[model samples]
Target: MIQRIQTIFLFLVVVCMGITIGTELWEQAVNGQSWKLSAFAVENLSADGEVVSSSSKWYIGALAAFVGLLALISIFQYKSRGRQMMLNMINSLLMVGLVASVFLTTNGLNSELGMEVAGSYKVGFWVILAAMVCNMLANRFIRKDEALVRSVDRIR
Candidate 1:
């Protein structure tokens, strides 16, 4: 079951979510000010590039961890594709919230620093989006597998 294509996809979903914790989600810089947001922390810098402040944003990290845990759990539910599919859907919704929260928090922080929302999404954003895509792919394959099993049963 672990060798299945959907299993691989599901595993990648977990890996991507886990990686988000260590990566920057968004950033901005203008006129000697810069702000960077990661999963668990946000950094602010003055014009001199000195570390002005850093604050813990634990909720982002916690949500990301929950998403990863769900994907990992889904990978092991190979015997029940229905349950796996449900979990995948839930994971997808969670991922959407995760992305929105990251951007919202970053924008809030950027505004506080008097910088326009000029920065694009960083590597972490892409990774979470990748996980969402993987979850969708895995769900599709799971449905295919269920249909195959039902066809074989009906033939018997």
Candidate 2:
């Protein structure tokens, strides 16, 4: 069961979330300096002279980690395709929330710093998008499996 296609897709989902931890989804430029916001940290790339580091919002990182771990755990629940589907749905919601929170945070940061934020989406954002798609596909496959099992039982 661990060798199931949905398991592989779930693992890919986890990898995408893990990679998101290190990549930025948006970039903002304030006074000619660019600041890229990632899931775990924000880096302020100074254009003129000095460099400063920005700390991360712990909850965002925690949510992302939770989603990834959820997917990983979902892979093991082969006995319960329904449960796996539920987990995938939950993961999907978590990812949507993560994206929304990121945008909200960027808006707050922009106003605080008097700058405009732009979609300088790095590798991380795209990965998140991929995870979203994978989650949907996993759910589809889980439902398919469940239906197949039901039909087999009916035949028996």
Per model, how many backbone clashes are there? 0, 0
TM-score (C-alpha, index-matched) for candidate 2:
0.89
For model 1, the stretches where C-alpha displacement exceeds 4 angstroms are 47-49
Clashing residue pairs found in predicted model 1: none
Highest lDDT scorer: 1
Best prediction by TM-score: 1
- TM-score: model 1 vs. ground truth: 0.93
Residue-level lDDT tens digits of model 2 in 1-156: 788789878999999999988666777676778887777776787887455777767777888899999999999998989888888999999999988888787777777777644535667777888999998988888898999999999999
Which lDDT value does model 1 have at 85? 91
Q: What is candidate 1's lDDT per residue for 27-141, written digit by digit as tens?
A: 7877677777889888888988788999998999999999999999999999888999999999999999998898788778767666655587899889998998999999999
Q: Assess each prediction's global lDDT (C-alpha) against the native.
A: 0.88, 0.83
* Whole-model lDDT, model 2: 0.83
Each prediction's RMSD to truth: 1.5, 1.9
